[model samples]
Target: MKKVCKGLGTVLVLLVAIVVIRASGSAQLDAPKAPAPLSVQPSESAERLGKAISFRTISHQDLSQVDTGQLTGFHQFLRESFPLTYAKLTVEMVSEYGLVYRWQGSDATRSPILLIAHMDVVPVDPGTEKAWTHPPFAGEVADGFVWGRGTLDFKQGVMGIHEATEALLAEGFVPKRTVYIGLGFDEEVGGVLGAKRIAAHFAALGLKFDFVLDEGLAVTKGMMPGIDSPVALIGIAEKGYLSVELLVEQDGGHSSMPEKETAVGILAGAISRLETTQMAAAIDGPAREFFDTIAPYMPFGQRLALRNLWLLEKPLTWKLTQKPATNALIRTTTAPTMLEGSVKENVLASRARAVVNFRIRPGDTVQSVLEHVHAVVDDARVKVNPGEGAADPSPMSPSDCWQFDLIEQTIREIYPDAVVAPSLMLGMSDARHYAPVSEHLYRFAPMMFTDQDRGRVHGINERIATGEYAKVPHFYAQLIRNSSLD
Candidate 1:
């Protein structure tokens, strides 16, 4: 009994010592004190953003649903709105709607930089329009918000970049390396015509970039649980996308005599299995680095757990998975998005169908996800097939590069109080298509958002605060100026 007690005590002391050492070794990363933010007329930017939003350049999965008139109007509006940019830079349209603006640099040796955003947004749901305080397409600036469809996910990026460039041109500022802005018109669906072609154009020219920055992570508040300060998340990598259809076909008859298990029941069971047995979670790649960087800012308990993740990965994963946002960072998620069981209420389903969408995380493949589905479902009654638009995750960008350092320094320079951390982008972006051209591709939007505002992006009442909207232009201008110094 004494020996057992001694052994337990020794283990406890060892654990405590290790935790203390890890915590002590961890240092909180901070941005150096920066100058007061440049005065960009935010109110004017807000008004301009409203006018930009009035155009309904919406992305529809079916090409027939697109309105070409709206695109032309929006294109013309940009030219008229930013006169200095039009005069100073060479603008070209790739694949009809893809907008590319080139500001040629003086030096031949320096590489170029590509700034990206999508000009298109997802169409609002049919019945959800009435729920908005302001109409979705009216582009109303009311109650401090520029309310509209693309405000958050994200025409803010589109207009904001233009707003910055126009302001920079006004000052007669020129870059040492060329600056290219690529705007995709169909990013909300896929960027085949827009970003893909823009990428090809750049490739054809054999023009390599220092980095590519697009819309993804943001300066979000109160989203992460442990950290108190607003975190400026820079997306160094993004999750892959895959959709699988679960089809169950069997004999169908009247509802009078039903079998023990119907076609719909089998399909439901498969979905349930997929949900319950999700792909395994791990803290590696961008996700792992994200936690490591943020650990010093966390509370002692959280800090201790994170710093010693090598010893406590399982329990820590359980804790992180409790929340949906953090959970997504570490795992390939399974969401059953669509269902088609029966046409009529009284009739049995002859063929039942379900579509499960997965945002594949790092360290997992499309094949592995399919294998997991087959293993968990384990039913011959169901047939699994891949849906359209399956994509593997983009290659992870290195955070150690001068490109990342510049973005981090810029974020810190603008918002000295906020903590800057590299993150894995959970959503898909047009930035992914640029990998063939640039090795350093990052996705970050310079807007601060709360938890509620987070849901508004693709949901109803999507908006951006007019006051905060000015920072978008200010940050971009600074980044452009900083990037210019060769």
Candidate 2:
């Protein structure tokens, strides 16, 4: 009896200490103040963004299907619109449409900074073309918004960078650190041909950047549960991509007389089993760091739970898995996008195939995921093979570095109401290709996005508010100025 009482007392004391320590940490946390605002002309900036979107620079997975003329026209449009940028910055075309502009600064000893964005946009689904309020490539300014495909996904960064650089050049503001602006044309399908080559070019010259900034999560509103303020997620790492084809073959027969199991039935069962047995969820790595940073500002209950993640990891992970967005952060997500079997309803399938795509989480590997699939299906007949473009997750960038601080400070200056946090990008970007060039690659786009706006990305009615569209140029301008200063 005495020993049990003593153990209970010790447990109680430890719990109390955990809460007390978490409380102290929360008490010390205060929101950072917003920096002074920089001004931008809404009409001029919006107009330029609109014109940039007018060009249909869509990337097709099959290069032969892509219209090279559209890519060339877009390049010509950029040269005509930003003549000041063309006159001042040394622009070189990488591959065919990849644009790399070098703005030589006063200091040569310091490694340059790279600003990344893509010139290409995903091809609009032909079926959904009529569903858009404005034609996908019309680039019309309507209802106080710039409506176009790349208005949010990227073209915002592409034109925004030029707009900022041109304004700075006109004002005679020269950077103390050299700056390179890289715009890849094949980022939509995969940057293998475009950004990959650009990074190699820099590598051959023994070039290293202080940091590389690419289009990623933006100033998001209403995403986090407890925090009332908007959150700006600077992507420090991106999930790797893997696509595997599951194939099954069986004896063919007529529909009237079928065997006990057919190829389609076996493949479908395997897919079902794979989906039912998901990858183990973990509340660690970048996802945990994100919650840790935001815990202090969350509601009291959420703050307490998050602050005690060591004790409540299981429950928190379960809660995160309840939502798709949060779920992706916690584990490698399995999505079976395409499946094929019989060509006709009357015929039984002799062979079946399905493509299962995975966005690999940090601390997990492509091989591990494949192993998990094989283990889950547990069928000898199913043949599993890795599809093309399988890649492991990119290495995590340092959050404590000056590059991150600069990005956070710039975001605070532009959107003071936002709570900035380091994030793991679920989608692949051109930044992955630049990973070899810099250890400190940060992914952020300086636009304010809401849940509704986020859905518009690669979806119908994609648009950006005139005011929101205006702020992007000023944000890039300030970011360049502050980071370039000696």
Candidate 3:
């Protein structure tokens, strides 16, 4: 009995020693930087962003609600706002409102770099206009922020690209490789009319870019667990979103004389099953890369778990699942967004419909999700069909490449103390549409976000700080210079 106790204690100490040794070997993530921030006058740029927000280029689910006049006028606004950019770059409109500009570089041998952003913004909720500190479309630049709908959902990205190009043009600095800017007008509604068409247009012309950058992740603070410094998340890939509608049809009867299973009850059961039995979560591909990249910055205990995921994957995964944000990094998320059954409360719901949205992890597909749904629900009464915006997850971009290094270096230039890491984008972006155009697709916007600030996107009081707005142009200019000069 004494020998058994001694053997167990010896094994435990050896395990602890192994964890310590592995964690101690982790190299600190300190990227060297020598570049400085590029120029964008904060107040002036904030005012410019505010004015752009006032255009009312909102995307609606109903096509008739979209005002073409406002979109056309936005093109004119860009013409007036940046005179030098208009004069220097060759501008071509694709799919009516999608604008494509090409800045001719000295060496056409080098493949061009593409920077993209959407011009359209999601509309404010019906009654929430009065709730805003400033009116949603007022384009108010006050209180250290440019307050409006597009401030965060991304008119800033559109303006940032132009501001950088105009500055570079003014300084007589020419790109060694051709630079292309794509401004899609309908990104808020799945980017079908905008980025998809523009990407096809690029393909038809046999233009394969070196890399394409779009807005997704940002410089986030207090978002990462067990890390103190601000981390710049560069999205190497994005999750595909799928919407599946569950339908049930049953015989109608009086509320007092209900059938054993009404349509509403059937749909409710299907939804419950989906919510409870989520897609299997595993650390693979981009998620693995994310954990590995940020492992060095974690506290010793967390560092041990991260560095030794081979032995501790299940326990660490369980720990990560405790947080909603971290749980999303590992699996396909199921969300029941819409449901319709009966108009009156006392009436039996003979026919019911519900929509379940899934943000697919890299290894899963639309077909696979449907299969899982059918297998799990295992009910003949529930009808399942694909809904809007079904797409497969994008292929992972190479993390160890010159394009990635340039992005890291440029991030360090502006955010010297920040840790740069490759991350998976939880939300869909227009960047995914350009996958056919470039294998090297990255999604990152150079704005700072905190835990309290993330809800502002497509939510009330949407705004970006004047100081943060200034960094966007500098980040782009530096990225352009670094990529082009290579």
Compared with the true structure, all predictions reach lDDT values of 0.89, 0.88, 0.89
1 versus 2: better lDDT goes to:
1
TM-score of each: 0.96, 0.96, 0.96
Clashes of 1: 0
Q: Over the stretch 229-256, how does candidate 3's per-residue lDDT look in tens digits?
A: 8999999999988999899988877799
Lowest summed lDDT across 10 adjacent residues in model 3 is found at 29-38
Q: How far is candidate 3 from the true structure (C-alpha RMSD, Å)?
A: 1.9
Please report the TM-score between candidate 2 and the true structure.
0.96
Model 1 regions lying over 4 Å from their true place: 1-8, 25-39
Task: Name the regions of candidate 2 deviating beyond 4 angstroms.
Answer: 23-40
Q: Which candidate model has the greater lDDT, 2 or 3? A: 3
What lDDT score is found at residue 302 in candidate 2?
Answer: 85
